[model samples]
Target: MTIRTFIKTTGSVALGLFVATLVVRGEESAGKAIAVRHSSTDDTATIQVAGLEKPLVVLHITDSHVTVADELEAQYQQYSSRMDKSYGGEKEHWRTKKKALPAAHFLNLLTLAKDRNVDLIALTGDIVNNPSQSSVRFIGKALNDTGIRRLYISGNHDWHYEGMPGSDDALRKTWTQERLLSLYPGRNPLCYAVQIGGINFVAIDNSTYQVTGEQLVFYEKETARGLPTVLLLHIPIYTPANTSASASSCCGNPVWGWETDHGFAIERRERWPKSGNLKSTTDFVDRVGKTGNLIAVLAGHTHKARTEKLSDSAVQYIAQAACNGGSRLVTFAPLMRDKN
Candidate 1:
């Protein structure tokens, strides 16, 4: 059997056991429990814990690409093939092969979050293979099962090609911005703020690839509030100061230099300028730096975990690892110096 088939079979068996464990544990812990509900709120769900004052923990999970059984093996094969091709057709690949178990990896991530006692879970987007209604619903159900206050946004994959069968017009009508917003509000909320532990966490929909005029306006308002802030988005904004050739490097090699050297570009075309300019993102970062209270910018979509200190600013920009197997834990304290 192929790796794809093995993953699917193992995931199915594991899920069955997980459900059984939950049932037995629920029965044993509680005498008579009828319903199991999960938290889907985007706002901060705060709970006071011992020894930690205003402890805010955000679990960042990205790019799970969850799908049902029928599509799982095929989708895995497709992604695996693409990764191999991108790496110059070498079958003995590690990065792609090592991180193919989306379902099992997601379950492990959930278990880790529960173990850490995370206060909130923020999904940076690309939750499904495509914008199929069933896939979206499946993602929602999986997240709800985690029982953590969750926030979801759209990555480019969520609506790039419109996987649902329909005409262009019908696809437009069916997957309207409203419908997508209802499904994934964290991305479409257009710069909403959630306050946890006296710090304002701002969710910006940078999935469009570029910062829009409307988003700039929202950023201005949030900055004016002068509250300690944490910005969350699907894509990490470009920072030129920390470009090095390493796994942890933010802006070099596979990330910003994929095309010239390896025949691939990490970023999609629409979101980035062909001239290879970082002006838009830099402008936004400069504005954010002026805010003084901006703590850190958290993002995903590059699938590589990296952290870079912005030039002349205290704001740390971090990209979490892909949810397929990558993991990142972001901690925010209420009283950090406003160097950024």
Candidate 2:
């Protein structure tokens, strides 16, 4: 079956209006970052984190789906061309209101981030259509030029070499090491944590729609540190409210068990294990719900804007695809104590 592309224009962007305002209650931790209030305009969302000493501005970007190949990696040119056309490489930009290619849509976001003096750019996943050497290098160079701090993880497409001969696990490891490791530097490409503005940002690669035992343990240890935390992953964790018919229902789709993806595997020329999600994957999801210090979960696989209330205090924010000229500005500022 041929995959079809559809662009869903969000009311926030299309109507050029400010959406709802959410009051986030602060946690009891004395010095931890706490969400106080949230407000958003067309392309920006400002979140107030209480007990913060200073404001931290972060730009959330996802699913840029950059498609390009250098001469040496001509083997992937066909795949690149296919994805470029799928995303409408020459479509008009939503933010800039100008015609741009998929790559330009990504670059334009970086320019906006820099112009806004964004402290960090949190890229959830699918930044590249494929982990081609040239495509990865292009993203790295462009980001470095902006001198903005960034954290990235792979989406399914990021490490997949369509029609490649290998198990999904082996392919991911091989291509990630060969083409995408530089972006990670000394950190573990599968899972790692960083502290920016005293808030812990833990990133995990859940592109496979499953989590490994080691990653689960890593997540447990990281969030146990008791600081305000934000969890980032390529696929959004399962939520009952996500009733979309698209394959975007990821992480732990109830029916996504063994043999459920025969059509998907064949369509993408990739492997799906006969055994569905491991017990560890479900445990990870349960752990996410119970983690007290976790403030927000940010993800991007669906390429559509969404927010799911995970718990009374925690909300998951999903960004639209960057290829569709979508980006979100999230500002964390100290809460005004007297307001509450």
Q: Which candidate is the best by lDDT?
A: 2
Enumerate residue pairs that collide in model 2.
none
Model 2 worst lDDT window (10 residues):
1-10
Q: Please state the error at residue 336 of candidate 2 in Å.
A: 2.5
lDDT of 2 by residue, 1-340 (tens): 1111121123342211111123233641212223444445545665555567899999999999886667867876654555545764575666567777889999989999999999999999889888888889999999889999998888888888766777678878988999999888688999999999988999999888889999989887887676777899999988777778644357876667656675454435554566767888988887776665676788898887777666433567788788878878888777543321
| RMSD, every candidate, angstroms | 16.8, 8.5
| Residue 120, candidate 1: alpha-carbon lDDT | 78
Which candidate's TM-score is highest?
2
Candidate 2 at 303: error in angstroms?
A: 0.5
Reference-based TM-score of each model: 0.61, 0.85
lDDT digits (tens) for residues 1-340 of candidate 1: 3322322111111110000011123222211111111111121121112122565787877766554334543543433333223322212112345544555666767887889888878777666554555556666666678788876666655554433344333433344362455655544454677777665677776654445556666776774565555677776655555454433222211244223323123321222224442445445655654444454566666665555433222234343444445555555432221132
lDDT for position 270 in model 1: 28
**Error at 251, model 1, angstroms:** 11
Q: For candidate 1, give the lDDT.
A: 0.49
Residue 133, model 2: Cα distance from true site in angstroms: 1.2
